[model samples]
Target: MKCSAPLALASATRGRPREFDPDQALAAALQVFWRRGYESASMAELTEAMGITKPSLYACFGNKEALFKKALDLYERDKLKYIGTALEAKTAHEVAERLLNCALATHCGASDPQGCLGVISMVGCTAEAESIRADVVARRASSEAAVVRRFEQAKADGDLPESVCPTKLASCLMTVLQGLSVKAQGGAKREDLQGAIDTFLTMWPRR
Candidate 1:
């Protein structure tokens, strides 16, 4: 994302005020939410990480919920780029391999915070954060639906066994993906996760 100077308020007057890059601030907020689940992330922590005051955060990004939604959008746009690529695989097995490999890279990246941000937010969510949980669930459902559709096409193209159920397969794959996130959060090694994925793929149904 490109960095641009913050937009000036129309009502601003008098001496010039400090300006911070909105894109940079949003990115910082994303890291905080990624490290700490949405509900557990404190407003002070968000502001401190974003390098902005609470008033500025509110003025630019609305409330915490709104900020989280924007951060989630950023995460999907950036971190989930491999998903689109995985959908383009020539075979169902290839698609599953790419998805699992990409997910492993993402969940266990050395420079990134461990675990999946969506998983953290959704799983750690409380009843008070029902709206946030619902939002994450809806987004996840959409992704799962895309995987299901892709698997259905694969079955139609004879890339998968006729006996395989696209919906169930999609669910199974996603369940493994989520489990990877949990394991990564629990400090599981990359080799261990890779081994598990290999085992699962080895057992994948064939035509």
Candidate 2:
């Protein structure tokens, strides 16, 4: 269920009436959690970044874990879907390109550029970070499985040779994408990544 935006909650104080745009608020919350992690992300930072009050923050989203889940949902819905959707392409090569360029734009794209939420979340806060970290891990596994399934389909369709192992190739593609994402977060150029993409394309099994 969607809630009101932080904008609406920002205007009015606690106990008073205020309209909020849930999506906008959730998006802002997502950024905060993405940058700071759930434990490190405080209500002040969230409300401040969101331009809303603590009560409004609590009201809109139940608590920190809930907010984190909401943020993850948004990431899954918005960011992670890029690769899965792109893998639906007619050719396996397109699938690879789509995965790489998507990683390029997503992990390193412009405007409030933050590294991957998955990697960022996995990096710090060991004890308090278990649930979110687990979620990200599961999400990644699911994503890899999806890509592998696509590669298997591509082989079945004769888009690639029968001799190739789709799971292995998909694993390679996913690893390449993860590496590209790490490089991208560190300022890897689009063309450089594209060059890598081109290299992968040439190596496709064709017999």
Candidate 3:
């Protein structure tokens, strides 16, 4: 839960110039919402956190909800970009491994110790988190579908045993990855998450 300090709030006033720094304000707002859910985050707290006045906060990001959404979007764009690249892997196995491994690696702080913004920061925010959750759900579905497609190809190519079920295997793998995300957020180590993945991979159909 070690968070960076909030940045300053800057918004263009009267179209003259950005009176304050928008990035810092948005980042400060992000910390506010990240620590406290959108419903729980207060205007007083956000203004204090952003080092700005009430009207200025509203002027920059509209309302609290818009500000929260903007912060969430920034998080998704910056931290969740790993997912986009992983989806382009040659096989579903590769895709799933790359997706979860990269996530766990970064999330566990092998690179940075902040756990994960996607899974960790949004834990209790079902209402305000719908869009972000939908993003995760959609990504999981698309990734699993890709896995299923690759499994089908593998079966056709005689890489998997005839008993393999693409749909079932994909579902199982997705479940494993979901578990990994939660575990990583809960302070699981890279080796621990990798072990879980290895166990799941062993469940794959063998020729």
For this target, which candidate reaches the highest TM-score against the unseen true structure? 1
- Off-target runs (Cα >4 Å) in candidate 2 are 1-16, 36-40
- Candidate ordering by TM-score (highest first): 1, 2, 3
Q: Is candidate 2 or candidate 3 better by lDDT?
A: 2
Per-candidate TM-score against the hidden true structure: 0.90, 0.81, 0.66
Q: What is the lDDT of residue 86 in candidate 2?
A: 95
**lDDT of candidate 2 at residue 46, scale 0 to 100:** 89
Give the alpha carbon lDDT tens digit for every residue of 1-104 in model 2.
23445324444454656565767888988888877767778888988888788877776787777777888889888987887689788888888878777776
- How many clashes (backbone N, Cα, C below 3 Å) per candidate? 0, 8, 3
Per-residue CA lDDT of model 3 for 24-43, tens digit only, reads 78888877665565666789
Best by lDDT: 1
lDDT of 1: 0.87
Over all chains combined, what TM-score does candidate 3 have? Answer: 0.66
lDDT of model number 2:
0.76
lDDT, residue 205, model 1: 89
Q: List residue ranges in candidate 1 displaced over 4 A.
A: 1-18
Compute the lDDT of residue 32 as modeled in candidate 2.
85
lDDT of 1 by residue, 1-207 (tens): 211233323334545654877778888998899888898899999999988999888877778888898899889999998999999999999999999999998877856437889999999997688988999999989989999999999999998998999999999999999998998888888899999999999999899
All candidates' lDDT scores? 0.87, 0.76, 0.67
lDDT assessment of candidate 3: 0.67
